[model samples]
Target: MKFKKRLWKKVSSIVLVAILAISVTGCGKSVSTSADASNVTVVKVGTGNGMPPFCSLDANGKAVGYDVDVLKEIDNRLADYQFDIQSLDFTTLLVSLDSGALDVVSHQLVKSDVRKTKYLFPDQYYCLSPLSLAVKTDSGIKTLADLKGKSINESPSSYEYSLLTSYNQKTLGNTLKINAVSDLSTADNFKQVANGQVDAALTYQSTYKSVQADLKIDNIKLTDTVLVEDTYIMLAKGQEKLTAAINQALKDMLSDGTLATIAKKNLSEDVFANYTSLIQTTN
Candidate 1:
């Protein structure tokens, strides 16, 4: 009887030890699976769909473009943060960013003093492009002077509008006619010009090149450059930390030639090269 009792005690001890070991191992895996930051800080980025080479939806319903690529590279370097993209229309993007629905925007946004009052821009720009007036080929419009008292359509929220507005006020003494459109595509702008609804349109050189053939804008021609603006990833107001982190990532990419590589891959040229000289040449 004594021997049986001792044997039973030993068996109970062994079973308890085995059970405790299994419990510990299971607990460890559970803790690891739900590790820190599972409730992570996710950065919401907004971009417009169908804006090719900048931001667009792929067949897999993914955001793929030059802007998206740069954002992904930044996200890869930021382990503490997860970045997600929401595709919206061109006009809706600004509203969403202002309402805090989006944390960042990278649809070829240009920094301007007017914009600086509303949103925060990073310290560096990822790309640059010259602004020019797109008009009908035979419109006989060749310079800013030709736009005097002439009508042009542009998005009110766009920097192009502000640029043109500045030119009207400061350079031309506000004689140019500015038509504010809520939303307009590159094709639509060219169409308006082609149809003689507007005498001219303000657009980026890169934008014209990308959609010129598609729009079949044989009748439209670009005037001499008006201004050159550097494009940046716009952030919501008061995101100083996020802005600094992104700026650092951009600088790293610039130094490592990643920025130029991405530009070449998407734009077919190094848009960053000689940007200073290009901007200087703009009037």
Candidate 2:
């Protein structure tokens, strides 16, 4: 009887140990899944529409471009965060962010002085987007000197407008008539210049390539770069955690050569390969 009792007690102890081990593991898994689901935060990301290769509407009106893809990849790496991307007008992006409707602006954002004062930016730059002047072949606008006292088209909310405004003030004596146009697409701006409606328009070569292929625009010629803008992801102020995550993602993308691949697919060239020649920079 004593031997039987001792054996029964040992068996009960073994059974209880197994039960507790299984229970703890099952409970841990359930709790971990629940915590993961509940802790994931949704981040609102915004990008400007009408800018091709960076952000634009597809045939189905879905937002597609390098900026969009980069945001998606960033979202993928951060399991704790979900990104909801919105493609909107260029000017509307900044306005929405200021109103607290957006948590991030994923457009090829230039870290201008004014913007740096208002928005937070990741430490790593994703791309170097250089700006050039688009002019008619016979427009006699070979250089900035040639654009003196001439009119140009730009968006009021853009850094181009500020640059042109300041350039006109300092050099052209405000004679460079800068037409503030927000509704015109980038192609239309080039079209206006091609049609001689404006002497020139500050734009990107990548944009002209899309315009040329899509609209058969041949009269416009791109001059040397005027600005080499250091583009990065823009976040609303005080988002240190999100900013850190984005920076890490950018660094990883760079290390893995994904940034170059994306740029080549959309921009037709690696925009970052020794992009050091420009009249000025938004660094």
Residue 167 of model 1 has an lDDT of 76
Local accuracy by lDDT, each model? 0.80, 0.82
Backbone clash total, candidate 2:
0
Q: Supply the global lDDT for candidate 2.
A: 0.82
lDDT of 1 by residue, 10-120 (tens): 999999999999999877623123336575469999988867777878789888778888998888776566789788888788889889899999888877777788888
| Model 1 global lDDT (CA atoms, 0 to 1) | 0.80
TM-score of each: 0.79, 0.82
Q: Write the per-residue lDDT of candidate 2 for residues 188-213, one digit (tens) a residue.
A: 88788889899998877787777678
Candidate 1: Cα lDDT at 148: 78
